[model samples]
Target: MLQRSFYERPVIQVARELIGCYLVREIDGETLVGKIVETEAYAGPLDRAAHSYSNRPTERTKAMFQEAGHAYIYEMHTHALLNVVTGRVGQPHGVLIRAVEPIAGLEVMKQNRATVKRQIDWTNGPGKLTKAFHITKALYAHPLNERPLYIEEGEKGVKIARSPRVGIANSGRAADYPWRFFERGNPYVSTFRK
Candidate 1:
């Protein structure tokens, strides 16, 4: 599992570095592992796309304010999305795991995402990945280095790629910021390069 120090850096840095790392989760005594492929950065209050922009305190964002390496989970469109808390406490920096490539426990992952017909579709997006791993709000604020859910180190030498974030058109220039990171040529990356 990755140590807390790995997530203590800036949110953008953590998001970029997460590429090729393994995201591990345990459900019903079965282990599920996926290689982190895509990520989007939401840096503190200054970044308008971030939930903590303007320092507007709210319960939904509470997990995002935790110290580095915590899980910040929320539900959207009835699908649970997972974000990794980064930076120091009160910073509210987060790295959204947009997509992952299945690494192990294929049977369990397929069962968890029973509705997905294609294997690649099972975890090609944030919501899809959470479902494939059975992740939910129950893991909110949980440490990323602990059991049930954690990140493992991956092999090096993978090429990293970045692009403007997706689905945030209303955030002005924030939408144009190249805050999304992914492994170059990785098929599991969400919203493939144009």
Candidate 2:
């Protein structure tokens, strides 16, 4: 298991490498584990799609400037989604964890989900994974290589594919950067767009 270091590498590399890792979240005496299968990269300052582009920092985006491998969690509507801020200090870039394949604590995930019709449906989306894992603002900027909430290395023998980011209709050329990575034909992938 390759435990991630907060300063191990650049955001792009981290984004590329994260495709096969596992995201584990422990909460309320239960552990929810998932195999990471999808990610999207956001580069620093110059990347228009990045939150820290142009170095314009805000309270919400402040955590993104933290060292690499730190979780940058935030709320989207009523859902909290988890992201990993990449790049070194003073550089605000990140990779959004788009989806994961549930591995452990699935019963907890079934309970967290709105409608767990099947095992795969338990953690098929970013927001759904957050609910299953109990990820929230409390985990914002938390280091990814540390205890309680750390990334665990999983089956590391799959090929990854880079594609244009989903749901960023207005990012212009940045939307076409092919930074989104995912495992081909993974059932846990979030395929819906809205």
Candidate 3:
């Protein structure tokens, strides 16, 4: 599993390097794993697109300000979005896990995302990947270097693609920042492009 040092780096660097890592979750005696395909970096305070922009803190944004290697989960439109907190404590930096490619326990993922139009849709977006992986607010603020949920080492030589982050079009120049990273030509990446 990835250790604390893996996440205690600049949020932008952490986000870019996450493209080919493994996200692992174990629940109810079942294990599900996916290869991280896409991510969007939200640098703290200075990043207007960040939840903790300007150092603003709230009940929901608390996780983002915690030390690195924690899950910064939240709800939006009734769907859970998962983020990996990065940098040191009080930084509020994080990387939103935008997509993943199913690596194991696909049956469980299919059950979780049964209505998805295709197998590729099972984890082709932030909310979709959370549902497919059974991720929820219950994991919010939880450490990510341990059991139940953790990141594992994965392929190291993946070619990366970059683009503006999805949504938050009103965040001024922040909306145009090329902060999104993904595996080049990965079929599991989100269909939306900036």
Give per-residue CA lDDT, model 3, range 1-194, as digits (tens): 98989899999999999989999999888999999999999998999899899797799899888889999999999799999999988889999999999999999999999888699989999999999999999898889998899999899899999999998767999999999999999999998755
Give candidate 3 misplaced runs (Cα > 4 Å): none
Cα lDDT, model 1, residue 144: 96
Of candidates 2 and 1, the better by TM-score? 1
Of the candidates numbered 2 and 3, which has the greater lDDT value? Answer: 3
In candidate 1, what are the lDDT values of residues 131-162, reduced to their tens digit?
Answer: 99999998989999999899999969889988
The TM-scores of all predictions, comma-separated, are: 0.97, 0.91, 0.97
Error of 2 at 73 (Å): 1.0
Clashes of 2: 0
Q: How accurate is candidate 2 locally (lDDT)?
A: 0.80
The global Cα lDDT (0 to 1) of model 3 is: 0.92
Q: What are the lDDT figures for the candidates, one per model?
A: 0.91, 0.80, 0.92
Candidate 2: tens digits of C-alpha lDDT, residues 71-173: 8888888888888877677788888998899888977887878566777766677787788787889988888877578787677777888788778767678
Clashes of each: 0, 0, 0
